[model samples]
Target: MTAPIYVPFQHCDALRTLAVPYGCGIDTVGVDPASAAPAGIPEPTLTPGRYLQEIRSAIRAMRALHDLLPPTA
Candidate 1:
């Protein structure tokens, strides 16, 4: 089976412009759930339940999009 095409971070804007022609949309995930403790940065202090919920939501969104795409050729 062919793998899903992966565009680098720098090329994201280009992908957005080309998405229409390619019949695909971009999905971005910027959060790192593994980092529970704040590292000098102002971040939300989510309870374990909330953290897991956020992760589940993101995964659900991605999976939904993946299901819509045609299988790799």
Candidate 2:
């Protein structure tokens, strides 16, 4: 099987920043989800289900932002 793509921490941070309007928390955004469970990252103080819900909410927000932005020239 092919190896999983590993993103650098900086890139992960950038993604989080872009995804913020989607409802991602400042602290959670800093975390690399791929690395979180493996690196013994602590569970988000929030419930797992709630975290996922917020992520979904954030994605919707991002989509709205995309729709509102003018298309590139």
Candidate 3:
């Protein structure tokens, strides 16, 4: 993965297509070590620790929810 290039988080979605021509092809974006999301794109202004905690919590909830469902015969 390539190194990150910081950009405003507000422009995150909009800048993606626009940046492609500037040589920011999809592969050039790096994975964020903290959030495990794409890098270069600005991290959300929210607290990283809290955000990650919430993500993990949500995943656990989803797994638990799936487990609660009846298994296919």
Candidate 4:
């Protein structure tokens, strides 16, 4: 895990880490789902790390393209 980055506006003390199924993004990472259920928000399956490779590839491509593009005014 990467070192925690500080965001001044965030309440770090209030953050809670909940375990979700592997590869599934946690909807209740910070807030409990039971509290949110009353709002009618249906939890959806979130794919964690599925598109990560593609994202890293895209970023690398962008960095490569940056060197190829001529400098702008």
Q: Which is the leading candidate under lDDT?
A: 2
- Sorting all predicted structures by lDDT, with the top scorer first, yields 2, 1, 3, 4
After the best TM-score superposition of candidate 2, give how far the Cα of residue 40 lies from its true spot, in angstroms.
30
Model 1 residue 2 lDDT score: 11
Best first by TM-score, ranked: 1, 2, 3, 4
TM-score of each: 0.41, 0.39, 0.36, 0.33
Task: Please report, in order, the local distance difference test score of every candidate based on alpha carbons.
Answer: 0.47, 0.48, 0.47, 0.37
Predicted candidate 1 versus true structure: per-residue lDDT over 1-73, tens digit per residue: 1111112331344343556348566564444533543567654455688657656655655565556557998
Question: Tens-digit lDDT track for model 2 on 1-73?
Answer: 1111222333344344565446554322244454556566564556678657656655665566557556998
What TM-score does model 3 achieve against the real structure? 0.36
Every candidate's CA RMSD? 9.6, 10.0, 12.7, 15.6
Number of clashes in every candidate structure?
Answer: 0, 1, 0, 0
Q: How much is the lDDT of residue 30 in candidate 2?
A: 43
Candidate 4 residue 23 C-alpha distance from true site, Å: 41
Per-residue lDDT over 1-73 for candidate 4, one digit per residue giving the tens place of the 0 to 100 score? 1111212112221121112113334321345444555577765433456346445644555565455556999
Instruction: Please report how far candidate 2 places residue 50 from its true position, in Å.
Output: 0.4
* lDDT, residue 70, candidate 3: 67
